[model samples]
Target: MAHDASGGEIVAAAGTTGGKKAGFFARIVIFIRQVIAELRKVVTPTRKELLKFTAVVLGFVVIMMALVYGLDYLFSWVTTVVFGVPS
Candidate 1:
């Protein structure tokens, strides 16, 4: 089975091969059909699950931002010590 870029989970549909280039409108129709098909396969989370996911994401982002800020502060302190305080 063919693998996608992120992982081996995504495999192209069977027998979906490239043929002659489609016309502009034909390509647009094909794109819309593909989008709808993918959307149909999507599984949306429940309200509670969505809230939990959002909280986890926000917490992780806050933690990461704090870490980056801490590191930046540390580097700036070190730089100031090594080069003397700027006027």
Candidate 2:
């Protein structure tokens, strides 16, 4: 662990030599290489699967909206009755 200027504990990099530091360009190149590797591993879904996922997400959102609206109406009704106001 390494401490910062404010004495907060900091985690050291794994697989590091414990003394050597990587240059800015070296770090950028490594980051780009890792991103390319990850992109190569990605498997895009088919159009039918994409449509199904979108429909499921939309249905979930609609259900959640209805649930929230129902709760809000119930709470408002209860509050109005408690406060002796017109509902």
Candidate 3:
């Protein structure tokens, strides 16, 4: 229904009538259909792409962990110096 800056058309869910609740089997079928539709839209990465993504994520996590550890250590040291060492 809408177009993005890149000129890609966006599909919007249409609201018709206030839809009646589906029965249990009907709901399951609807769910399976939706899942298959979503799966069809998925783009899987190649092995090289997956490796690069994994490296980037791991590097980010390690950097964040080191940053947090440094801050916590600094705070603990300051607290100990100000309040004296714990008994």
List where candidate 2 sits over 4 angstroms from the true fold: 1-12
lDDT of 2 by residue, 1-87 (tens): 454454433444867777656567866765676566667779999999999999999999999999999999999999888898754
Q: Which regions of candidate 1 deviate over 4 angstroms?
A: 1-21
- Local distance difference test, each candidate: 0.74, 0.75, 0.74
Summarize candidate 1's per-residue lDDT along 1-87 as a digit string, tens digits.
333443322334547885445567865766676566677779999999999999999999999999999999999999999999878
Candidate 2 worst ten-residue window by lDDT: 3-12
Model 3: CA > 4 A from native: 1-21
Worst 10 residues of 3 by lDDT: 4-13
Which residue pairs of candidate 1 clash? Answer: none
Backbone collision count in every prediction?
A: 0, 0, 0
Question: Could you tell me every candidate's TM-score relative to the true structure?
Answer: 0.68, 0.74, 0.71
Winner by TM-score: 2
| Candidate with more favorable, higher lDDT: 2 or 3 | 2
Top-lDDT structure, candidate number:
2
lDDT of 1 at 53: 99
> How big is the RMSD of model 3?
6.6
